[model samples]
Target: MPIKSIKKARKLIREKRKCVNASQWFCQISLAFFLAAILTNQLAYAFFDIAFLGELSTALQQAKVVWNVLMYFIPGLLMILAATALVMAGINGVVAFCYKQQLASLKRGEG
Candidate 1:
Protein backbone atom coordinates (compact mmCIF):
# COMPACT_ATOMS: atom_id res chain seq x y z
CA MET A 1 0.00 0.00 0.00
CA PRO A 2 2.92 2.37 0.71
CA ILE A 3 5.23 3.88 -1.92
CA LYS A 4 8.17 1.88 -0.59
CA SER A 5 6.26 -1.39 -0.89
CA ILE A 6 5.12 -0.47 -4.41
CA LYS A 7 8.70 0.27 -5.39
CA LYS A 8 9.87 -3.05 -3.94
CA ALA A 9 7.17 -4.96 -5.79
CA ARG A 10 8.09 -3.28 -9.07
CA LYS A 11 11.74 -4.13 -8.60
CA LEU A 12 10.97 -7.73 -7.77
CA ILE A 13 8.79 -8.09 -10.81
CA ARG A 14 11.51 -6.63 -13.01
CA GLU A 15 14.12 -9.02 -11.63
CA LYS A 16 11.89 -12.06 -12.11
CA ARG A 17 11.07 -11.03 -15.68
CA LYS A 18 14.75 -10.63 -16.47
CA CYS A 19 15.53 -14.10 -15.15
CA VAL A 20 12.72 -15.67 -17.18
CA ASN A 21 13.82 -13.87 -20.33
CA ALA A 22 17.40 -14.97 -19.84
CA SER A 23 16.32 -18.59 -19.41
CA GLN A 24 14.26 -18.40 -22.59
CA TRP A 25 17.18 -16.96 -24.51
CA PHE A 26 19.47 -19.69 -23.24
CA CYS A 27 17.00 -22.40 -24.31
CA GLN A 28 16.74 -20.92 -27.80
CA ILE A 29 20.48 -20.76 -28.19
CA SER A 30 20.88 -24.34 -27.02
CA LEU A 31 18.31 -25.56 -29.50
CA ALA A 32 20.01 -23.68 -32.31
CA PHE A 33 23.33 -25.29 -31.51
CA PHE A 34 21.73 -28.74 -31.36
CA LEU A 35 20.11 -28.28 -34.76
CA ALA A 36 23.31 -26.90 -36.24
CA ALA A 37 25.32 -29.90 -35.06
CA ILE A 38 22.81 -32.34 -36.53
CA LEU A 39 22.61 -30.52 -39.86
CA THR A 40 26.38 -30.19 -40.18
CA ASN A 41 26.87 -33.87 -39.44
CA GLN A 42 24.34 -34.81 -42.08
CA LEU A 43 25.96 -32.49 -44.59
CA ALA A 44 29.40 -33.97 -43.88
CA TYR A 45 28.10 -37.50 -44.40
CA ALA A 46 26.44 -36.47 -47.67
CA PHE A 47 29.62 -34.86 -48.94
CA PHE A 48 31.67 -37.92 -48.04
CA ASP A 49 29.26 -40.17 -49.86
CA ILE A 50 29.22 -37.99 -52.97
CA ALA A 51 32.98 -37.67 -53.18
CA PHE A 52 33.69 -41.34 -52.50
CA LEU A 53 30.97 -42.59 -54.84
CA GLY A 54 32.28 -40.52 -57.71
CA GLU A 55 35.70 -42.23 -57.47
CA LEU A 56 34.69 -45.79 -56.66
CA SER A 57 37.44 -48.50 -56.74
CA THR A 58 38.73 -51.50 -54.84
CA ALA A 59 40.83 -49.36 -52.50
CA LEU A 60 37.92 -47.02 -52.06
CA GLN A 61 35.79 -49.94 -50.93
CA GLN A 62 38.26 -50.80 -48.18
CA ALA A 63 38.45 -47.14 -47.15
CA LYS A 64 34.66 -46.97 -47.09
CA VAL A 65 34.55 -49.91 -44.67
CA VAL A 66 36.76 -48.07 -42.17
CA TRP A 67 34.92 -44.80 -42.71
CA ASN A 68 31.56 -46.45 -42.16
CA VAL A 69 32.72 -47.89 -38.85
CA LEU A 70 33.79 -44.41 -37.72
CA MET A 71 30.55 -42.89 -38.91
CA TYR A 72 28.50 -45.45 -36.99
CA PHE A 73 30.04 -44.34 -33.70
CA ILE A 74 30.13 -40.62 -34.45
CA PRO A 75 26.34 -40.21 -34.32
CA GLY A 76 26.14 -41.88 -30.91
CA LEU A 77 28.86 -39.59 -29.59
CA LEU A 78 27.14 -36.50 -30.96
CA MET A 79 23.82 -37.56 -29.44
CA ILE A 80 25.41 -38.00 -26.03
CA LEU A 81 26.97 -34.55 -26.20
CA ALA A 82 23.74 -32.97 -27.30
CA ALA A 83 21.78 -34.69 -24.54
CA THR A 84 24.24 -33.44 -21.93
CA ALA A 85 23.96 -29.90 -23.17
CA LEU A 86 20.16 -30.07 -23.16
CA VAL A 87 20.03 -31.46 -19.63
CA MET A 88 22.43 -28.80 -18.38
CA ALA A 89 20.41 -26.04 -20.00
CA GLY A 90 17.18 -27.32 -18.47
CA ILE A 91 18.73 -27.52 -15.02
CA ASN A 92 20.09 -24.00 -15.37
CA GLY A 93 16.70 -22.63 -16.36
CA VAL A 94 15.00 -24.29 -13.44
CA VAL A 95 17.59 -22.98 -11.00
CA ALA A 96 17.24 -19.46 -12.38
CA PHE A 97 13.48 -19.60 -11.97
CA CYS A 98 13.75 -20.83 -8.40
CA TYR A 99 16.23 -18.08 -7.53
CA LYS A 100 13.99 -15.45 -9.08
CA GLN A 101 10.99 -16.66 -7.07
CA GLN A 102 13.00 -16.64 -3.87
CA LEU A 103 14.18 -13.13 -4.56
CA ALA A 104 10.62 -12.00 -5.10
CA SER A 105 9.49 -13.58 -1.85
CA LEU A 106 12.42 -12.09 0.05
CA LYS A 107 11.61 -8.64 -1.27
CA ARG A 108 8.11 -9.01 0.15
CA GLY A 109 9.44 -10.23 3.48
CA GLU A 110 7.51 -13.47 2.97
CA GLY A 111 10.64 -15.68 3.09
Candidate 2:
Protein backbone atom coordinates (compact mmCIF):
# COMPACT_ATOMS: atom_id res chain seq x y z
CA MET A 1 0.00 0.00 0.00
CA PRO A 2 3.02 2.30 0.24
CA ILE A 3 3.85 4.90 -2.42
CA LYS A 4 7.27 3.41 -3.09
CA SER A 5 5.86 -0.07 -3.74
CA ILE A 6 3.32 1.30 -6.18
CA LYS A 7 5.99 3.25 -8.04
CA LYS A 8 8.21 0.19 -8.26
CA ALA A 9 5.33 -1.89 -9.60
CA ARG A 10 4.62 0.72 -12.27
CA LYS A 11 8.25 0.78 -13.27
CA LEU A 12 8.32 -3.01 -13.54
CA ILE A 13 5.20 -3.00 -15.71
CA ARG A 14 6.73 -0.39 -18.01
CA GLU A 15 9.86 -2.51 -18.39
CA LYS A 16 7.72 -5.54 -19.20
CA ARG A 17 5.86 -3.55 -21.89
CA LYS A 18 9.14 -2.56 -23.49
CA CYS A 19 10.29 -6.16 -23.47
CA VAL A 20 7.07 -7.27 -25.10
CA ASN A 21 7.48 -4.67 -27.83
CA ALA A 22 11.03 -5.79 -28.48
CA SER A 23 9.96 -9.44 -28.65
CA GLN A 24 7.25 -8.54 -31.17
CA TRP A 25 9.76 -6.77 -33.36
CA PHE A 26 12.11 -9.74 -33.22
CA CYS A 27 9.30 -12.13 -34.21
CA GLN A 28 8.36 -9.94 -37.17
CA ILE A 29 11.94 -9.78 -38.38
CA SER A 30 12.36 -13.54 -38.06
CA LEU A 31 9.15 -14.26 -39.96
CA ALA A 32 10.23 -11.89 -42.73
CA PHE A 33 13.55 -13.67 -43.11
CA PHE A 34 11.86 -17.08 -43.17
CA LEU A 35 9.52 -16.03 -45.97
CA ALA A 36 12.31 -14.39 -47.95
CA ALA A 37 14.52 -17.45 -47.72
CA ILE A 38 11.71 -19.71 -48.95
CA LEU A 39 10.98 -17.45 -51.90
CA THR A 40 14.62 -17.12 -52.83
CA ASN A 41 15.14 -20.87 -52.72
CA GLN A 42 12.16 -21.48 -54.96
CA LEU A 43 13.30 -18.91 -57.51
CA ALA A 44 16.82 -20.28 -57.50
CA TYR A 45 15.57 -23.77 -58.26
CA ALA A 46 13.33 -22.60 -61.09
CA PHE A 47 16.04 -20.55 -62.76
CA PHE A 48 18.66 -23.24 -62.35
CA ASP A 49 16.32 -25.90 -63.75
CA ILE A 50 15.70 -23.85 -66.87
CA ALA A 51 19.38 -23.11 -67.37
CA PHE A 52 20.37 -26.72 -66.82
CA LEU A 53 17.83 -28.01 -69.30
CA GLY A 54 18.97 -25.62 -71.98
CA GLU A 55 22.65 -26.64 -71.76
CA LEU A 56 22.14 -30.42 -71.19
CA SER A 57 25.75 -31.09 -70.20
CA THR A 58 26.32 -34.19 -68.03
CA ALA A 59 27.98 -32.31 -65.17
CA LEU A 60 25.53 -29.44 -65.31
CA GLN A 61 22.55 -31.83 -65.25
CA GLN A 62 23.97 -33.63 -62.22
CA ALA A 63 24.63 -30.41 -60.39
CA LYS A 64 21.16 -29.15 -61.14
CA VAL A 65 19.61 -32.33 -59.73
CA VAL A 66 21.67 -31.96 -56.58
CA TRP A 67 20.69 -28.35 -56.19
CA ASN A 68 17.03 -29.19 -56.64
CA VAL A 69 17.27 -31.79 -53.88
CA LEU A 70 18.86 -29.23 -51.60
CA MET A 71 16.08 -26.77 -52.40
CA TYR A 72 13.50 -29.26 -51.17
CA PHE A 73 15.12 -29.23 -47.72
CA ILE A 74 14.77 -25.46 -47.33
CA PRO A 75 11.02 -25.50 -46.77
CA GLY A 76 11.40 -27.88 -43.82
CA LEU A 77 13.92 -25.59 -42.19
CA LEU A 78 11.74 -22.54 -42.79
CA MET A 79 8.71 -24.25 -41.30
CA ILE A 80 10.64 -25.16 -38.16
CA LEU A 81 11.83 -21.60 -37.68
CA ALA A 82 8.36 -20.22 -38.32
CA ALA A 83 6.84 -22.57 -35.77
CA THR A 84 9.41 -21.58 -33.17
CA ALA A 85 8.75 -17.90 -33.74
CA LEU A 86 5.02 -18.41 -33.42
CA VAL A 87 5.37 -20.21 -30.09
CA MET A 88 7.72 -17.56 -28.73
CA ALA A 89 5.36 -14.76 -29.77
CA GLY A 90 2.41 -16.57 -28.22
CA ILE A 91 4.22 -17.03 -24.90
CA ASN A 92 5.32 -13.40 -24.83
CA GLY A 93 1.77 -12.24 -25.51
CA VAL A 94 0.42 -14.37 -22.67
CA VAL A 95 3.00 -13.02 -20.25
CA ALA A 96 2.31 -9.43 -21.25
CA PHE A 97 -1.43 -9.92 -20.88
CA CYS A 98 -1.02 -11.44 -17.42
CA TYR A 99 1.19 -8.55 -16.32
CA LYS A 100 -1.30 -6.01 -17.59
CA GLN A 101 -4.09 -7.78 -15.69
CA GLN A 102 -2.00 -7.72 -12.54
CA LEU A 103 -1.44 -3.99 -12.93
CA ALA A 104 -5.16 -3.47 -13.31
CA SER A 105 -5.87 -5.44 -10.11
CA LEU A 106 -3.26 -3.41 -8.27
CA LYS A 107 -4.98 -0.18 -9.31
CA ARG A 108 -8.28 -1.58 -8.02
CA GLY A 109 -6.67 -2.39 -4.66
CA GLU A 110 -7.45 -6.06 -5.22
CA GLY A 111 -3.85 -7.32 -5.20
For each candidate in turn, the TM-score is 0.56, 0.74
Candidate 1: count of backbone clashes, pairs at least 3 residues apart or interchain? 0
Model 2 score (lDDT): 0.77
- List ranges where model 2 is wrong by over 4 Å: 54-58
TM-score of 2: 0.74
Worst 10 residues of 1 by lDDT: 72-81
Candidate 1 segments whose C-alpha is farther than 4 A from its true place: 54-92, 99-111
**Tens-digit per-residue lDDT, 1-111, candidate 1:** 467766766776676677667667666766766686687678769967786867679988898888777665666566666666667667767776776776667667775
lDDT of 2 by residue, 3-110 (tens): 966996787699679769967976996687689668968787787767666556888778877878767677667767777777778778887888887788777777
lDDT of 1: 0.70
| Whole-model lDDT per candidate | 0.70, 0.77
